[model samples]
Target: MLRRSKRSSSSYYLLRRIALAAKAAKGEQSRCGIVGRSSSCSCSRFLTTGGIDDGEDDHDASTSSSSSTTLIKKRINDEYVDTEAAMERTRMKAAALKAAGLKAESMTVFDREVKRAHRDRAAYLQREKKEEKEKKSSSSEGDFLLEEATRRVLDRLDDIKRPFKRILVIGGATVSTVKQLLEKRRDVETIIACDSSEATLLLVKDIVGDAPKRKFDSFPVEIKYVQAFEDDLPIKDNVVDCVLSVLGLHWVNDLPGAMGQARCTLVPDGLFLSAIFGGDTLTELRIACALAETENEGGVSARVSPLAHVRDAGNLLGRAGLRLPAVDVDTLTLNYKTPMDLVEHLRMMGEQNAVIERRQTIKRSTMELANQKYVENFSALSLSNDDDASMPKPSSSESGISATFQILYMTGWSPSETQQKAKERGSATVSLSDLKSALEEKEEEEEKK
Candidate 1:
């Protein structure tokens, strides 16, 4: 017999294997009986008549099937491994994020206890000063800022036509706001004065004691004092008709939470009003201190407590579930003979930095350096004309440093069915682009008439 070519022999073996596999897949036969081309098997004759080496063909066919099976298994294992790795990565990332959130929640910004202690200490120091004085000063020189803010706050209350039977005041340490509310507002029958410091709350007791005999005698309104943190009020929900906080709220570490708590005390359609120190309150002092610290210590520490910005006040109110939110600003600049006088004024106001990370004491060298910077950069020869003409005017030749206090006055109302709701978007029949033309046409008609 003639020897077959290597390519033809391999092709014939491949055809024979395909026939065997197909028959096995159909379950026609469990085994193929053809061991070689010479065997008289029916499958051998039908598969291929070409002459070929049986031994080598069997070896090659077995090797090809085993290799294909191994490749398929390897591919399946690779896909499974890839899926497991991705899941592990996702789990690790989720764990890291959860830990980071917990860390952020535990971090302290403004220490409420420290701030309360400072306010209490200030109250005691003021009492000592009063006991030593021969006569009480008629002018509230140290508390003029608070007085101005109080006046503005009351003016806003006056604009509202509705009467408030019950009012809650937070951080009314000076007690001027309470006196004004009792004297002016006939609708106000009960007042709840609250403060973080127990000593500060004690100051409101004078208001309670003198309520019956003073100007409020004409309208006997009940005044009660409560020692409570701004962030955690003791009052029940929807108890007060109006809530007022003057120069407070800024010191709270969790301002949004505190504002929500304040809102919770208000009744439906109740008012939420406050005057907080804006971010620009102590611009000059902040800059001077920052520069001095950077020059001396090669780094800066928290010398001033962070205050809210005018732009953010409205959003904060809405976030606390208040409606009809409004925010405005009132800026005041005070001229100080020296930076030290400014420091003393802050101490009197109990507005010293209570940040948890603040240094215990500022260095004498840094203080001197900051004073130099303040005078050099913010010196004013004469005070600018201000609306509050009662403030002492600087002499034409005298030079002093100026400090700016930007007060943010915010007002928000509790949600109620009676409150006005904004019109839906794209529901207007007229477009603002045509407003000017419409106004012009109306003016023409008016002129013709």
Candidate 2:
């Protein structure tokens, strides 16, 4: 019974070996050079060449053969190596993708940083705009007050009674009083109104309204409107008798050039009467901004450019070849319930527009903080003054506002020889020291008055 059991086990093992060999032979046949079923050059034929046949004795001999065992072992080893190589290729591909993903993440971070920088820049610009609006509001309020003061001066000038032939009105839009004065004077022959703003010219035309034809029949006065800059007046040299301007000269960016142009356009004996904002124009606002910046490091702190710094003005006029230049400085105090209200008045008067270089937008938060700081500082300072100091002596030209502005009124004439001389070699030169001296003298005169 033991011998029969052993024979059965041997037979099972032989059958398994034969099956595996047949599978390998079929796989080789599919991949080998053998084409037809009749071909003897197949793996099956090659294995059978060593005197092996399909029988019980042959099968037992094949199973015991070392060559067959070694072949089977080699095939199993090759299959294991192929599986491992495939797994290794898949792992390398996954690692490469992870590295690429990390690089993309780094690029996204850089892009976010750039966008943040742009947003910061935009915020800064908005803040600048708000501050500019505030400045314009203040300037407009000051201008209205100045117009009233100018009216007084005009009344005084009219009372003196000087004869004038041809009156050249530069920046005629803002000088309504001067225009009225010329219209009333019968001796005035021609009024040449010059301005860059077409809207202003139209307004001036409306004010005159056929009066030049009706009132002055004897002189037949002509009102000519010239659209020109201060530097480029479209008129004959040495032809005008008097040039009048108010709240206009400060808008000219190239003051010297504009002055030189004015000199060229004026007659030898022509008088130039002008009023402009000066260096001390917005003293209160400037002080407020400075105090705010110092107290809360969050507010904007930039110096406001004076309407007309006296030294610069005098120098500019002298450079234009004007003689007997008399510069007079005056302070006009105006009262405003709030800073924002003051700004609205300026907008109404069309004086809210700033020069291109000074133009900017301001942030709401910055402006609110600045206003609060200003109120605190102003109140504290006003209260600190001695109560017995004679009730804060009233100035010559004081309005209701707590703030005051210094405006410079200047009058000068073109040198008699300026018309005859070459444009380059004319009397258009004034020393800086002389201009400084003139401003100092004007300030001193104001104090004495």
Candidate 3:
């Protein structure tokens, strides 16, 4: 009997272990049975078949046992259902928390990345500004050198001797040159200086001083200042004996019209002498800007235009109806230490103004970036071997702020014998065939090139 009891205990323990294992595999919590004991006695009763002793007692006992068994089975099923439901709720809560944490981390990373980008952009803009200031200083210096060279050349021309009765000086700022010429020519009876700026005329009057004016006696000289545009000199045709201009024609908006007025003002044999700053004045600055834009890999504003260089002054003079026209153009180079210094000189000389239409103020960041790019691209080429290897090198034109310019000096007479002959030939007729031929020729030339 003791051995039989031991075997029964073993069997009960094995059955309980199997039930627990099944519940755990389904993600359910452990639960006690209806018997309120460690072993599953009620479950064992269902597995075994047995008979009753007396009829009435058997009937009552059997019914009671059956009812208890049914109650136990129902309790076990309920316990399993509750355990599974609780586990599912817990799993869902954990997943929600994890998702929220990941979202917060992503937001933090995104904010940091944005801040880093802004800081880098600001740094780039600052670097660009420094470069721009350096470039401007170099440009100004070059301009000063050119102006000085021009002054020297003018002085040489002043030494020549000439006689004149009537003289027209175009452009008013050059009052000093006119004053010197007046002092030299005792025979200059009447002088007219025409210019667009009223302020310039006033300055000229002050510079001329109180030189006595006479009509006919004692080497009479009369200086008259007229406010007029280059294209429309307020003088009658063939009224002046000589027309002279220096460093002013480039300012004229209408070069052709100005030339016509100049020609009309002079007598048939009247002389015309003029000097103009032609296209090559600021080649270095132009080239550096272009190269910098290419290096930066960006587009630049169209406000800057390449200055027009005169290819043939003789042709232009002839087109203006000048006789015995002679055009001579030469290049001049000038240098400066920095761009800012050059700009200051231009201001003093009243040449710092620009004609381009623009906004009153530029974006600080954009300007800074432009300057940096300019310096980075052009600084190396501007250096010279003589520059100290240890010392910091400049960004452009190693010979300080060097600039190249073309000085177009021209001399001619008003419409004379040759001009009259051409006028008499009447307008040269051009037919539709001629127009077609000209267009075809241009296209062929372009293709060949």
Candidate 4:
């Protein structure tokens, strides 16, 4: 009886091995990357070659003559392999563009914007040290809004529990965020800063110190520079733990597409934060320009690029497949002595007019009239103590005016299993009628109280 039981147990083990091998082979047939079913890829063949399962040869090839289902799987597997190979080749070629290539066809104005941004940033880097000295001497400031917005986003890092091991800062290559990251979180291990211009990355070396990898005192942070377009990121999916964009994403031709790329690059539940100019930005200037141009040229030309509305930011984030998206605005009302002062400040911030439809130059007559209209419409009083007067009057032509900037800060997270999921359709425990009745009862209880 013991000898018979032993024989039966051995037979059962052999059958189980064969069953598992067959099941694995069936699963292998449906997946991508078959590539003519090399022996290494097919489970049945692998098991056969390994001397584990000798009952079956290559399942599809051997069974095709007798089985219709086998022939169909073989055809589907071939197609899947071919499709996967083509996609991989295309993806590699896309990554190659970062070194020397082109933007995607969907990004219409992106190439042009990239060129302008590079030119502007290159000039800034070359003269940054000299300009700082000059700015100090003249008591004039620069890029206050950009730096301020960046720091504000940095302040929220405490809220994120996970360490950002791989960080991608899009369009903020010149402005180094490494120092702040090192100081705030010692968990930073790798920071990949990318921009359209090589010059910006060149200057970043100076800020972050020499070599590709930078060490902040004792902290270890590997920083790499890549010349990449905003819309076309040469990065693998779900590789980066964090993505940050400061005053840059708004310039992309296809904002939604860029956001989608960001979403894909981030790991599950990874953080993405950005601060961009909202539609309300430069309202005074937009209004003044329209009023001036309409009065003079009988129509308005494109003096400034159109900014995105705050209402649309949440929808855009959601469209990009990001979960728990949040959008808010911070209005910065800067006091400039004149409208031209605001223009100079904008130039210093690298915010020169780069829109494709922008006029070569605002007509001198239109420009002067716009300034006059701006002062009349938005100028604030520079209160001064007068010996004879109780209160000061409105600011003169030389007095300060308010230049409004609505910085829209948006935050989103990459999809994760732990995040809340919406209930399936028709699966709700309570019906609409039940919810209405419950609300009515609550309202009645409130009335009694």
| Best model per TM-score | 1
Q: Give the whole-model CA lDDT for all candidates, comma-separated.
A: 0.66, 0.49, 0.47, 0.61
Task: Write the candidate numbers in order of decreasing lDDT.
Answer: 1, 4, 2, 3
Each candidate structure's TM-score, on Cα atoms with residue i matched to residue i, is: 0.72, 0.52, 0.49, 0.65
Q: In candidate 3, how many clashes are counted?
A: 13
Q: Kindly list the per-residue Cα lDDT of model 3 for residues 1-449, writing each as its tens digit.
A: 00113443365456547755974665422121122111111211110012212222222221233332221221122211122222333355456657677433332211222222222222222223334667787421212333343353345445445555777777623554455555455567667766554334444454454353432344535565544445445456677887777665665544655676788778886777777777776555555544445445465432232233666567667777788777766665444454433333333333322333322343444444444443444332343322222322233345345444566777777866644343345466876789999999999999999
At residue 389, what lDDT does model 3 achieve?
Answer: 29
What is every candidate's alpha-carbon RMSD to the true fold? 33.5, 39.5, 43.6, 22.8
lDDT of 4 by residue, 1-449 (tens): 00113443355456547756985876543321112111111110110011122223345443433221121132111211122232354467567665465655533543445354534443353445445767789642224555566766776666777678778787742463544565566577777666665445545544545433333456546665544566666556777889988887877777887888888878888898887889988888889989999999999876777778989899889988888889887766666777887775565455655676566666788888888999899875343222212322222334668766787878999999987877879898888999999999999999999
lDDT of prediction 4: 0.61
Per-residue lDDT of candidate 1, residues 1-449 (tens digit): 01223553465456547756974674432111121111110011111112223232333332233221110111001100121222343356457767777542254588777787668656655544444452665433325667678888999999999989888888744466776776577788777777776556555453334433225457666655555567655556677999999988888866887788788778899999999999998899889998998998898877888888888998899889889999998877777788877776676567888888778887888888988988899985355336565554332335788888898888999889999998989899988869989999999999999
- Least accurate stretch of 10 residues (summed lDDT) in model 3? 40-49
**Model 4 segments beyond 4 Å from truth?**
1-115, 118-126, 129-142, 172-176, 211-217, 381-398, 424-449
Over 4 Å off, model 1: 1-107, 132-142, 172-174, 207-217, 391-398, 441-449
Positional deviation of 4 in candidate 4, in angstroms? 98
For candidate 3, the TM-score is 0.49
Give a tens-digit lDDT track for model 2, residues 70-168: 111111011001212223433564577686774333322112222222222222222333356677884212133534545644644565456776777
Give the C-alpha miss distance for residue 373 in model 2, angstroms. Answer: 3.0
